[model samples]
Target: MTYRPTVRGRRLARELRRLRELQRLTLQEVADRLDWSRATVSRLETGQTRPKPNDIADLLDLYGVPSPQRDALITLAREAGQRGWWTAYADVFTGSYVALEDEASLIRTWDTQLIHGLLQTEDYARAVITAGRMLPTTEDIERRIDARKARQALLNRERAPQIHLIFDECVLKRPIGGPGVMRAQLEWLLELAERPQITIQVLPFEAREHAGLDGRFTILSFPDPADPDIAYVEGTMGDVYLESAEAIASHGERFERIMKQAMSPEDSAPLIAEAARSSP
Candidate 1:
């Protein structure tokens, strides 16, 4: 299958292009130094193709990068090549979005509807998937649920990424899969709140004006310094990945604005607890 390159893959490609330009190394020259085909180097730099670990090491050597920098570059390339676990559930998600989610070292998520994927309980996830009329089959739905569950593992990793999530009050009021499922989901969120690495906040309905009112979006920050930040905006049809510094900066400002308007974690926890209590 011809899967589209991920946001992280494209960002890695862009960085390679920038570095090559900085060194004034033509693609042919670099390829010659590495004894590789010019087309191979070009594809990798253009994000038309993914490169293996050995390929990354060879290219870094050809670029004459220092040891420390070379190691980081290689790591970025390796990450770009690894297939995301979501790929197994390719029937459920857009490929590019899955890749971006996997590469993110820090995720700032704001949602106005249901719970975000990383925070969703199994019942909640199943309910959401069932509600999507376009989904194909029961197996497909299970695959997606499994994929989401796997993604949650990132939160439990020894070096887990930092997640800061802000949810609109409407999300708490909307009951998916009836009250039992909703209660479990809210309880799950409450438990997640206790994690030192996670930060959860809720925006009250009375906060009539908020930056996230535009819709849900996520800002993904990478471990690789050379790779630029990405903003992902998903809608009914497709998703958009924002990579330019100006675009990233704009999203960052919006995130800050929403964070300022939303309730603090201390206040938000009680709100969630109250919602769980009210659930029938």
Candidate 2:
């Protein structure tokens, strides 16, 4: 299984590389000194491999990291190495989205297609995963469904993230799991909208050629300033995680524009309720 580095993992990787550079040692020199392969050293510095505490200790010793920073980084390495709930269904979720999403304190998203995954009901998720993934086995489909269910638990946690969703009008009309399933999903959306932490908006067709013509994306903000914000773009080819300040700022502007054009949460509630009631 490929190790998808989390924010802490990436931070630890950067620090390790910086420490080595400070000592003016090449990767080969470090590997030779530690009796590790050059490739192993490279992978650790690049976050391509999980950092073992012992391995991190050795690297710190080589760099003479000293007590304060050395202990801190080793602790970070242990946390980075810890497995999350999603790891159990690694085959289902092939990216770090779930892992990162688990850490977010706020989630903002714009959807041109289906409903946001967090708000999706079990049946709706099953439908989406089945049709989109083309899984060959019932067991495989169930496993994916289970993973999505686990992910939704984040919303109900004691300190759940503030979630705001802006979806195109067409998403309300698209019946993914047929009329009955779609109706249930929409009704659930209505129920969830009543929550204080959740906000929903609909971008009507009248607003033509808007900023969202590009596609859908989600921005995740963390409580810790050190973690920074993340902008995620999902694609059929592969998902993209944008962390740079410029990239995040650009996506932030796009989302703000989209939100401006979308119906207010108050106005959107009636529309969502109407869609749910009208769905037969």
State every prediction's TM-score relative to the real structure.
Answer: 0.83, 0.93
RMSD of 2: 1.7
TM-score, model 1 to reference: 0.83
Candidate 2 lDDT, tens digit per residue, 1-280? 7787777887789899999999999999999999999999999998889999999999999999999888999999999998888888888789889988998889999999999999999999999999998989999999888888899999899999999999999998899999889999999998999999999999999999899999999999988777779999999999999989999999999999999999999999899889988888
Q: Write the per-residue lDDT of candidate 1 for residues 1-280, one digit (tens) a residue.
A: 4455766678778878888898898999988888889999999987878767788787766667888878877887777777766666666565476666666789999998978888999999999988964567888788778888887888888888889999899999989999999999999999999998899999998789878878999998889786678888887787788878899999999999999999999999999999999998
RMSD of 1: 3.4
Model 1 is weakest, by summed lDDT over 10 consecutive residues, at 1-10
State each candidate's clash count. 0, 0
Model 2, total clashes: 0
lDDT comparing candidate 1 with the true structure: 0.84
Model 2 misplaced regions, further than 4 Å: none
